[model samples]
Target: MVKCFETGAYVLNGREIVKDDAEAQAKLASMLGQSADKEAAKQGTMAYGVIQAHNHAEQGGLLKLKFDSLTAHDITYVGIIQTARASGMEKFPMPFVMTNCHNSLCAVGGTINEDDHKFALSAAQKYGGIYVPTNLAVIHSYNREMMAKPGNMILGSDSHTRYGALGTMAIGEGGGELAKQLLGKTYDLAKPEVIAVYLTGKPQPGVGPQDVALQIIGNVYNNGYVKNKVMEFIGDGIQNLSVDYRNGIDVMTTETTCLSSIWETDDQVKEYFLIHGREGDYKTLKPEAVAYYDGLVYVDLSAIKPTIAMPFHPSNIYTIEEFKANAAEIINYIEVEGRKQFDVPNLDINLRSKLRNGAFMVDQGIIAGCSGGTFENLTDAADIMRGGSTGNGTFTMSVYPGSQPINIELVRNGAMETFMSAGVIVREAFCGPCFGAGDTPANQEFSIRHATRNFPNREGSKPTDGQISYVALMDARSIAATAINGGKLTAATEIDVNFTRPKYTFNKSIYDFRVFNGIGKETPETELLMGPNIKDWPAMPNLTEDILLKVITYITDPVTTTDELIPSGETSSYRSNPIRLAEFTLGRKDPQFVPNAKVLQKLEVAREHGENPVELDASLAAIYDKIKSIDPEKVVDPKEIGIGSAVFANMPGDGSAREQAASCQKVLGTWANFAKQYATKRYRSNLINWGMLPFEVSGDPVFDKDDYVYIPNIRSAVLSGQPEIPAYVIGDEVKAFTVKLGSLSKEEREVIAAGCLINYYKVK
Candidate 1:
């Protein structure tokens, strides 16, 4: 279904693919009537043009990007704004939209979510920004409707912030990046390589965007084929799919771990802007005549089938046919994978027990969030359930529109009525289901969702509490099909239903009436609405000369996600409060992590003051003695060492762009993260922004849990451009090992030395 080119390929006129080999120059010259220039061809990609338009850096390779717009959700905006305020920002430098979608429910923490909404509104008025109230729209939906413009770059604090389908290059990052933009600082990065996603053929009838997306994710995710690169979509198939279909596929590009994405826009995209009453934002965007890509993912749309990402990961995919054929084995494998995520004894996943009568039975179905709640997906889902009924059994189904406008359209077109008649509960435009806030299933129940992720504990089940549920990701169509089958795990192709692909009529009145558009109109006198739960960031310490790091927790998971690092769901209410949120760091992965890290933090606190750390923590004296034993000639003093905690994971920071993943570690006195490799650039950036050492140790981590690592003159190594630093693990005797800090920009180096982005800005 998907073919990845082993070597670089060139796209001729956005349609034909010419493999780069011995005869590549000859083939290119024959087509172009001249000698082929690979360097010039590289600039012909749509991504290159977008970057050129937004890039402010004079230097080649390094990019200093200034985005046309910025966006953030409730859980992230407060922290971003607080950081910006502390950084001497008076007003927003660009158009910033703060949407309350993630914590919209306000169900977990009493009045905590609503207080943030009020704070966002006041901040919008005070700082000259835009604010969308709770349940109005998800972060991406609001941006896609009003802010997306052809050839423009948008930076968001949410991971799924891709608007490439509309010819806009959108990147999701941590809150620090957004804060930097607010302070008129450029987003620095290395120029990313562009990979051609050459699409051909029309999708089969029963296929949906999630099916295609899952197929692509499965092929590219594990191999890192498109990691930290741009996936430039091109080809004749662009005319076949609707704009919503393209958007559904584009937003999921975040799952491929690519930096950003862009599409070859056509009349369909133009019509999309026209329908949304933003025709002025429309522009013709296509790759140049000859565009070279680092690699190519050639997709035959017709070959794609209804696919599902099994429990625990978006990359763990299987076609419905293949899964049904080997139901027992596949279910058993998922249970086994679930068991591996946590060490809780008596953790009974029991997915195999749910498989009865040769069919896998599910407990719930959810069609919600940015990827699934688009007008086209919802309409098609409603069409599938028009005459069918979701029987009253152990199964239930719910649908959430992406935005208020989409909800209104669904209500006006009788789609909502159809869903209601089919016994499906329709919800507001909330991102709760996607991140485990709403629609939480009962213990051990299985849910099939069309949301973004299905990570472990993402279904709101605390495995540590002996409450474990499962979520498998499928397309909205198949979820509807499964609903009709009473959650029998039926694919859309197995059911005969005519998909009424309705034309979406955009309604801007909903946002016009509810959203606060304070852009370019600053009211500096407006007071911010603060809640008891909202607190400013705590003081962070600067990098010291010699450092001592205690490995508090060690995770052997192949990939540890941000969700596992800090968690999402209920803890989101505490995002604005750094101290409270840090308490939950690694709460599920390691319950002892907080207490253990705090012990080291106390020692660090004592050392920071006049008090001696060895006196406070008697065991630390032995650690300092071992550190001095490493270099008998060189005297090592415990008073001069900076004491802190660290965590060791094989490959950490996979899923979300939540800064809390790194910020929580910073809050808990974490000074370093030892990983074989980082899963995504955003995670590494978060670590650097929070002033943590993103150390990559090849092969086995020489240190174990609770072991101490001492690095002398660490501050000099960071500021003097030292990529590889010498360190010794403290055991019976100090053992030598080397850890490499990957390439850091001058500004990034300064940020680390200053302790964090906030502290770096403080001096400026």
Candidate 2:
């Protein structure tokens, strides 16, 4: 189990935790004072040191960094390069890597995924970038194997771009940020507070890294303990974990809504660097003797049991023992939550029916992706599943290696054969299972996976289409145990198994033969292959003087994830084309969103040509009449106004760091989002990059669907850095409300003024 301490905790070399600042100073004086160390406690953390090394500007305050490397998968790289090219990029300014994994399946749209891969390969040659071809490796795994350097920061388009345990500080952001890096623009952000994740005790034999990670995520996610900050790991339990175990734990830190992560480096980390053929990248990293943290998460690894995160989120967790003992109660709760998430009436997930003879059962089990497909987890899973059968029933199992290198080792070490003997389908390196592209269960089937998420339709069942399934995330060890138990849910600790640790040999030839590494070697004449589905972005107008937004969907969900805004599964193939992808905007959460926004967008499009034919509903006319009644002599001109739609969510932008969540909203004529608070920095950045006003409401609003909200002089207010804007909601009665446009960098403000990142760079 994990415990979160309130802000201002001091940890000393994995031993003692002192809450009193004066006593902590006394303890630090006892250690560092004797040595006459002059380093400030705030700057002594591994996270601070790493960020400081990469920050090329002034050595204090805000960060304007230039990352040493950048990465994007197929779902992102195409759009990023397109935007960079549109923004006058000649060649990649730094090391840019594009991997084809998310859209590698090519099962949905014929030739669309392969066309993207081909375009990426050609783009890499033309832009002096590196390319990992289809099924070679996932984005994060490839970067960890080749590009992660100690004390260097790497920015990626995918959200899980963390490599802290490998002695590198990596961040996952929207494609707009990566495009800025490609154009040699500095990444601007305020210096974030660092939280200490103090690990103690050792995990028991059957427990895996995912179990420990889920425990940490569950404790931090709901309470906002580490939101938009860095988590710096320093503790004695680091001595017990392998490099892979640390990596498994580190990658999932993104789920905690942290900005980035770092860990104290040890010999295992050094060996990891050496194994990846980057011995020079290995360096000892730790917090200084007098390091200070704004907050602390104390995790006793020994007490953590095999855990499972129930449907819809990673934070809804329970130990495997606790879940089985209360399956009926848990199922009832989950089924109720599912009805809200899916919006399907009478859609019940029957987990209790699977309980036969006092044992809970599942239809399928999966062990794949970066968290589950690592060498340690799979090897341990193979041990648990050895000499066992999955049985001839509805239950099935699939395992995917994280990379070709890991896949080679598994096959060479006979673990692959052992898993196959147990009727497990071992596949190539693909991220389909993690995001809903492959191995989707049947309707109403319950699947236990060790992938990154278990959100609604994350396994590919369409609830709106009367097909709803469930995915509960568990550790690979327990997943393997369940597979061997003939689909009955079983924790790994309940099974007696001994693992034969195998040494892995890294092979570079697999990548050399198939992968394209064209860094520093640009072929300018190369032509990019374009599929019919691949299209350029539509032109967007700048922010108008007066703006009008209609509240289309008023969502009351506490935390609306990016997946809910724009789904991940089949819609991923349409990301390259903004217009096509916009159709899926809020398709999962609010089915009527696109039509409503599209209707309002036509008015704005018509006004762009100075042809303002008044086409207003009676409700809209009442708002315009109210404005006219206020100042009839000035005359509110339609030519000077812009019409768009907006949404009101309690809290939005949680899960994935996909920019499409915001971009699709922009393309659909969404001008603003009213939320209590954003879930992550990446989501807010996405909104800013897409030119939407991220409005934070102070109190209850009198806004409803089809109601007009008018903001006068919005463009001037944005350019002048006005935090609060006077907005009026037009309903039966004209009521006014205030919306705060939180913190924004100068460049972010300019991006909003210029309409979007693409337009901002176009004019610059």
Which candidate gets the maximum TM-score versus the true structure?
1
Query: lDDT tens digits, residues 285-373, model 1?
Result: 99988889999999999999999999888999999999999988888887777787777899887888788888889899999989999
Per-prediction TM-score:
0.99, 0.97
Cα shift from native, residue 596, model 2 (Å) = 0.9
Candidate 2 per-residue lDDT over residues 15-40, each given as its tens digit: 56766454565665675564223245
| lDDT of each candidate versus the true structure | 0.91, 0.86
Give the range of the ten consecutive residues with the poorest summed lDDT in model 1: 334-343
Q: Please give the lDDT score for candidate 1.
A: 0.91
